[model samples]
Target: MRNFYSALILLLCFVACKETTSGKKEAEQHVMPSAQAVDTLLKEEKKPAPKTFRTFENLADTTFVRLADFSDGFAYDLRYATKNNFLKEKVYDCAECYTRVKTAKALLKANEEFKKSGVRIKFFDCYRPNSVQYKMWKIVPNPQYVANPKKGSIHNKGGAVDITLETLEGEELDMGTDFDFFGKRAYHDNFDLPEKVLANRKLLKETMEKHGFWSIRTEWWHYNLKAGSNDKVANFKWNCNQ
Candidate 1:
């Protein structure tokens, strides 16, 4: 009788311990956080909030000028206007081309150092309107070379720039082809290009990148501000001439 009672007590203890272990295992499985869920939460926290400011229309009463006119440190020989082998039409209200202005100032300061090397910065295109961007897109919808007109282009926002290298006397270097050329030749790293052209492209790219500008891989002449997207849109109509 004593042996029987001890055996029964041991059995009961074993069953209770097994049930408790199973319950704990089940709770652990249900309460664990998924790796994906944690990653998603981290990403959500990293996103920046959008900003709002006064519209361009609200600043209509204030005077504005093209960045080029505001400072003489940089030089502008609008390539399109000349009877050269390049496009020749000005599509921006010069005064409202803030990106160009900012770029010019940076280049001017950089040129002081580049002048020792007999190199200078030149402008090919600046401050394009949405209308002209659409026209260009119709000509070539190359995503690597040109921005889509259906979407708001950085140029339309007055923050995109097209530029090249030139001699102090204003002679353009061989950058493979004209600005907006949609071909492999325009690539900064094209192996078939002459060494001089490649070197010139590298100089322009490095200098611009140093001053907070980034280059498009497909077009050597194209460089937009690294932080240009931060600029808010203005509803103020451009002053055709400033």
Candidate 2:
């Protein structure tokens, strides 16, 4: 009887030990999954945002569109809206870059090509109302400085843009001169500039030309879209508070 009881107790002890080990392993499995699931959810929350672009199919080629609504990649430092420009007065109620659909399309393609070289277009000016052109004419009245408001500038026609190259990191390229710097230093034909400046201007000019844009001999920063220059000059304005 004593042997029998000792054997029975040993058996019970072995079963209890086995059960404890199994229970521990099962608890570990449950705890591990919960922790891993929480970690995965946190990672998902930190993922990068999806890219967004506006649809342009419905818009007419001549229709003026806000460039920002189409793509967020381009940069803007609209000069006429502030006193920093040669005008020395804020002629616009706000700074907004608008262009015709065709011009915008060409610009978008040019920007894509620019991105391949780690650069992008930064606009100094865009579609200007004839009224704003008149204001600029009032300041300088020179046909050379401000395009005659009566004839209407390519800007008023939504065909031209004054722009420069900037890196993806927002550093401006050495284009030798600032936008609207009415001097020989700002001319595309000027070759006396630093090599880097010439190269930068070359890249800008070539890429724009390939995209149906033509640069003026006098201004390195100005580009006119061939298809849009014939469009009617517009006096319509954009909403400033929007």
Candidate 3:
């Protein structure tokens, strides 16, 4: 009877130890995943929010601002920033589009109108600094082509832009000649071209005019804001590192 009781006690002890081990393992399985999930949530919470475009509210019309910061709706080529321009030299350290607040406003409006026609404005240049004008003058040295830096053209005043229209897919519309083409083919008055090119030029001209921009007779791509012409010429340069 003593041996039988001893054996029974041993069996009980074994079952209790097995149950305890199984319970510990179950707890570990649940706790490990819960801890990992909590860690993932914390990482997600620490991440920064996505960036967004800035607004022009409360900013003075004369204030210079980067166009990309205001809206991502427009396109940029910035030819002078590269060697693709008439100067055939990379004049800018980096590509950027800056304009006076009023000019940006007019461009935004004009772009919106262009979008309605299934196209958008692509900028070749905008708000050229007075210093850059001087560089361009040294390269070209032609009053008819490069504006005299000393006299300060409308571009130096942060009001002028060289632009073209492109389809929503980014295919450039034919405007007869390339940008900075110093010839009759680029003339706004030249109508002896294909119907499509003429229509494209007409669309760009009429829309820009409606938004208080006036085109020069010689260059099909150049447009100056009528109000922006009075703004003082600026030599403010954008930071290329940014």
Candidate 4:
């Protein structure tokens, strides 16, 4: 009778140990991932990289380039392409800002600085063709207002731009007068204006000057790239429909 009880106890102990081992095996199987799953976790999903833009390294300094093609950080309200300008007529077939590669480089750098101050460059005019200058002269023959197409202005050389500063929200800051306002109010030295207007002009002038551009006395918005003064006047026109 004693031997029979001892054998039964031993058999019960063996079954309990076996059940514990089986439970432990299932717990480990639930926690551990399969080899394929481990591979998937270690490998990253493939995705296309963003496109890189070309730099001016290979381009000539005089080569004309569309500003938007290099950087979209600028705002455009090309006045000559629309009748909103002083000419009261649309002289340009399209609204595109093209400048010499050297000029574009300086502009891009200047814009980068402006962005840090929560403002950006808004172009009123850029790279006016020699032919367009003649049309402007026909409407406003005054040398104070329009450059003679015969001699050609810095704008015809793809080196000059008329610009204003605006908040990132597109609200143009008060520069004392509207673009192409042919009067004393637009003069950079005319500090007789309000304090706010002078401040705005100062900001535009200082920031632009730091980027290798010089401002004319009469137009607060006009800036000429120092290097662009010598480039030949061009009649390069952009396609309107494209």
Candidate 5:
């Protein structure tokens, strides 16, 4: 009778242990993450947040010139070489010209207000080719007004703009020297300028600033649209006509 009881107890103990092991195995299988869930987690980890505003890279080439629809008579001198001293002899389409089309339209609308005041906007440089920019960079590697090509320029991206104020008669404003002049006369806060020139610069800066444009401290004529990300670099092919 004693032997029989001992054997029965041993058998019960083995069954309980087996059942515990089976329960543990089932629990582990149930708790393990699914392959689909793991893949989804990895995908989420890789994904970046969407930008709040549209960037230049997100835009098509055709979208860059949409501002032209809003205004007429604003000639693109880079489309054809003219005797304009401010223009580079080699014409090339500007990437920034397209990127800032919306800002350009705003500038045109603001020009209408300026026109009421007998003023017009004159562009010196727009989209510059990497080649031309490279040339300029070589000439003046560390210009106060211009950016280095090694670092990439707003002109390269079709986003940097250099312009000045003019009169309806085509006479340039006293905002100081000719455009692209590498001197203090082009400096934004050069107090040596005539009061009228200073006023004109102030007007241009204020108008551009109001329309989401920011000017460089070194060049009164240089302004960038604050619309796109700074990281966006454009290597768009330039057409002879911009």
Candidate 6:
């Protein structure tokens, strides 16, 4: 009878041990999923939110707007913002592209057309403040290059842009001279250039004209919006901290 009791107790102990081991494994399985779920949630939270662009739906045409805030399609060099420009001095506090709402609209349309030709506009300068115009004039007091600050060029009116063509992949097209090149080589009428360069310039000029922009005779890169010419010359500066 004692041996039989002993055997019964052994059987009970084995069953209890098995239940404990199984429960432990089940608990571990539950705990592992909870840990993995927490990890996934953290990763999702750390991910950056997608960028959003502003629309010109109700904005006034004369209102100034940053081009990058509207679209990410175009490129910029913004030479005056750096010392690489003809002035050899950094004129702008920061590099930012801003234009009148009407000018921006025309540019967006022009960029779309340029994209069709596997190229896009790359700006060297745009929408210069009247104050910056004075800085440029002080550096080069030539009417042929820098416009008079008192008179205020189309740029100060937010109507002009110095731009060039580049491939969608960001390769600049050869147009015989770089931006701010003051010579006959950069002149629109001076056609003594390689066929490739002339073709590139022609593409830019024709496309810009189609999109309500007119080029200057002296500078192939400079273009003025036909409708934005009458806008007031602005000294409004962009906030660089943003």
* Top candidate when judged by lDDT against the true structure: 6
Worst 10 residues of 5 by lDDT: 73-82
Candidate 3, 1-242: lDDT as tens digits: 99999999999999999999999998888677677798999999999997698899899999999999988889999999999988999988899999999999999999999999999999999988999999999999999888899999998999999999999999999999998898999999998889999999999999999999999898999999999988888999999888
Per-residue C-alpha lDDT of model 1 across residues 61-100, encoded as one tens digit per residue = 2222365444443456554344342334343334234443
Candidate 6 residue pairs in backbone clash = none
TM-score of each: 0.59, 0.84, 0.80, 0.78, 0.60, 0.82
lDDT score for candidate 1 against the true structure: 0.64
Q: On residues 1-242, what C-alpha lDDT tens digit does candidate 6 reach at each position?
A: 99999999999999999999999999998777676798999999999998799999989999999999988899999999999988899999999999999999999999999999999999999999999999989999998778899999999999999999999999999999989998999999998899999999999999999999999999999999999988889999999999
Displacement of the residue 62 alpha carbon in candidate 3, Å = 0.3
Better by TM-score, candidate 6 or 4 = 6
Mind giving the per-residue lDDT tens digits that candidate 2 earns over 1-242? 99999999999999999999999999998777687798999999999887677879888888889999999989999988899998889999999999999999999999999999999999999999999999889899999888889999889999999999999999999999888888999988899999999999999999999999998999999999999877898998999999
Of the two candidates 2 and 6, the one with more favorable lDDT, higher being better, is 6
Model with the higher TM-score, candidate 2 or 3: 2
Better of 3 and 6 by lDDT: 6
TM-score of model 1 relative to the true fold?
A: 0.59
Span of 10 residues, lowest total lDDT, candidate 4: 44-53
**Model 3: colliding residue pairs:** none
Per-residue lDDT value at 120 in model 2: 95
lDDT of each: 0.64, 0.93, 0.93, 0.91, 0.65, 0.94
Error of 5 at 181 (Å): 2.3
Quote model 5's TM-score.
0.60
Off by over 4 Å in 1: 1-65, 77-104, 135-146, 232-237
Model 1, position 148: C-alpha lDDT score = 80
